[model samples]
Target: MPIKLHDFQQEVVNKFFKSGSLLCVLPTGTGKTVVALEIIRRLKEQYGNKTKCLIVVPANLRSNFVDTIRKFQLKLNAEIIQKVSQLDQAYRTKTILVISYDFMRLYALKLLRYKWTLIVADEVHYAKNRQTKNFAVLYQLRLNSRHFLGLTASPIANTPEEFFTILIIVTGDRSIFAEGMQLIKYMEIGRKDPTWWEKLKATLTGRRPRSKKGELIPIGIKDIEAFRRLVGRWVYIPHYSKIEKLGTRPKVKSFVVRVDLDDFETKAYKYALRKIPRQDLKDLKEGTITNARLRQIKNIIMACQQTLLSPDYIYEYEERGQEGVEQSNISLFRPGSKIKAVAKFLKQTGEKTIVFSSFLRFGARLANHYFNKLGIKSREYSGAVKPQERKEIIKQFEEGDLQVICLTGAGQEGMNLPSCKNVFFLNLPWHGEILRQVVGRALRITSKNPFVRMFWLFAYTKDGQETIDLWLSNLIKRKDIIRNAIFAALQETTANVSVQLPSYEGPRPKSKRKPDTVLGINYPR
Candidate 1:
């Protein structure tokens, strides 16, 4: 079968012009990878079989490239090699090499030695920080970069400069930005579109409509089927009752546990905050660091987060533990609300849980300090873990050999642990997208248990000293905005189609969310 492109996808790809460097920003499920593959096909046809391409993706996605290559029957010799020693073993012939971002950073100089025809970076938002290894290596790689393609679903950045900065790394020439900006200014794309097109465009851009534009009508199971026929892969959301009847409903209950930071953590956090400029803190949350001092900033951020868990060095947060903490008590060495919260939840539920942490160091610390101290079998999953060990860890967790597994971003997407019904975020998520991903680990249609419980732990308080997470708060608000947008879109798009589910719920998962906005852009609903 030939690859099918939707009107929206075809339009975007047709407009791309296949210039030397390109940034393709499309939503998830809209087939960004398909667009990328199409671009590679055209390039290979024109540039000949000798053209070399490099795709740097998340570690879990290493096999996806190989599978895609096989499925499409692309003649390019594709290899997913992260080891620097193995690069020599690879054929000198033109090939497409797949690697992780961490590998690129680790072997930046070695990989840069290779002359590449094209470079494609997926999940490009991670390249926002210039001081970070990814950004630095990417900057240097641009010197030899010829054809470049950047792909991402979310253009996550607090500022336009930060967002466009990654394009600079891709393009290698900053002058292109001036030309791009000039083109954007003169372009008619952003101008007001027609009413019907505007509504469709809002859906395309993930914007919430201003109001509920249609009415919900009572319909039978056939109606739901029609809706599913119209919009593929989204029927499971609105037709909840029908799906539940089919035993496909994944029950997910979410809670946010409010906790306060201990004095040691407070002191460390305050000191770190004082050292860095205030805006940088906000920028880091957005995953964009314009400042070159990201090493120090990241260290400071790590220290603050570590205080919640146990830092390797006791002196990281304070010279000692709390004022009267006993030397024998584990709290003496490791004491914070995050640990206490996890320990409490584990003791209470005694259920296997996956505690997710933002940083790999924090994940390791949490497993070692809290879970191990509780006499529970625990493991850590991150980039540091060998691939084989990661598979072993997952197997152990499934077999009940491990009661808990502390995970970083590395383990979020790959694991299909429907058997594990409990997930705890020992730390606040950077954004709503991450929160969704974390919950998705345990919450699935095929969940082993009937219910999945997720506890999202946050340190929010009246006092300004402990921690402030406006980003998390605001990101969550968008969830409801998105939900409402979906509801309205369904009601309107499916109206003529006459699709609905009989015996449906009173209302589609009510989220008492008022209108909200982010970065001054009104998220319509």
Candidate 2:
């Protein structure tokens, strides 16, 4: 049976087949899996039973992919390959084999020996870091495969440089841009007053770059439009609004809610900051901190953040000797203002909500508070929860048995919670991409709620002095500027270019739109 596809997805699939390698970016809940499956089905039909496909996904997402295939009722021979020993047998028999990134990294060389007709990397941004072993493994596999596909909702999560590896993998051109110094030079090709060199020198010598006006100008993307044009050729990004059949996605209302810490908590925060070494503080003030000094400074900052959240996290960290700073002598079990604020917000909304925390102890403490204090049915979802238990928790949350769930970073990647519309961040991650992925758990296209409300909870001082939360928020805003600029380019490219389909041996379905020019390449229209 032929699988049904939305018009935009069909168009995207057509583009992938024509180009042989491409990156497909679709907003969460917009059915990226369906597009991949449709491409797989076509490859099977075109190449016969001998066609081989490898789908690499994050560990937590493996089940989601399998469940999607089952829901679609697709008869494609897909199997989850868990062991390196099973790889050989599965490679011979299965038409499509899905493996996790962790497993792939472990058996990279073994898997590289085999040829795959198509390689689909879901959440492909995981390989964006060139320093990661997964990137090296995926790079080789991309070279070995006949066709490569990278899928992600947020490609440039942190910076534009993250896209460099993904581009090289798809385009298979290591020298496409050039090496480090030359690459930086290329990025500054059109700049009138190039500052990359000065920035690099300052960075190496523990100094800051300043403009002619003596204002700090952080080194960042100089020409986002040029980068967009470069990356636009290999990417196909479609929004739900553009694809009418996908239905209207609810508009998201995001808020940054500031909570004031109580008197004692404020005192504890100040005490924690005082515990940092005077030399370290001076280094930070002078912007001359080494790697070790920077790490210690980060630890102190985290201790201060934990101070804002709860005393329980601080005690736990102190016990583990994780927080080098001294813990304030206060009641460790008492819930602080942030925790109380979260409880109040949850009780007031009375909607299914998910609280995200980067720290495990904080999430557990919050979940415990909800269950014991507020009487709201809640549980913790993190790496500590067994896979089977995680499934049960998700079932409970979806079926209304649970009202709140505290999710840690471990559960962020592959967990889908469309039933949840309210997301509260007890803590902020350093990267904007991570924040997006966590929020994506609820902002699915299939969500029942019309609007997904996201609250970023922050703690501030009475004097309005900026804290880690505010600093992190500002960082995310800067990162978003890069993402929005590149996405704008991709959106324009998608609108202007038309994919030229190959001639079919038999009949073809009719369409109202005609083939248009793409990247100066002429084909049958």
Question: Against the unseen true structure, what C-alpha lDDT does each candidate score?
Answer: 0.55, 0.67
**Which residue pairs in model 2 clash with each other?**
none
In candidate 2, what are the lDDT values of residues 139-218, reduced to their tens digit? 89998999999998777765555766777887777854333112221111112233433444222211223333222222
TM-score on alpha carbons, each prediction: 0.54, 0.80
Supply the global lDDT for candidate 1. Answer: 0.55
TM-score of 1: 0.54
TM value for model 2: 0.80
Residue 211, model 2: Cα distance from true site in angstroms: 12
**Worst 10-residue stretch by lDDT in candidate 1?**
496-505
Those runs of model 2 whose alpha carbons end farther than 4 Å from true positions after fitting are 177-229, 243-245, 275-296, 312-320, 323-332, 462-466, 492-525
Clashes of each: 3, 0
Give residue 166's lDDT in candidate 1 (0 to 100): 71
lDDT against true structure, model 2: 0.67
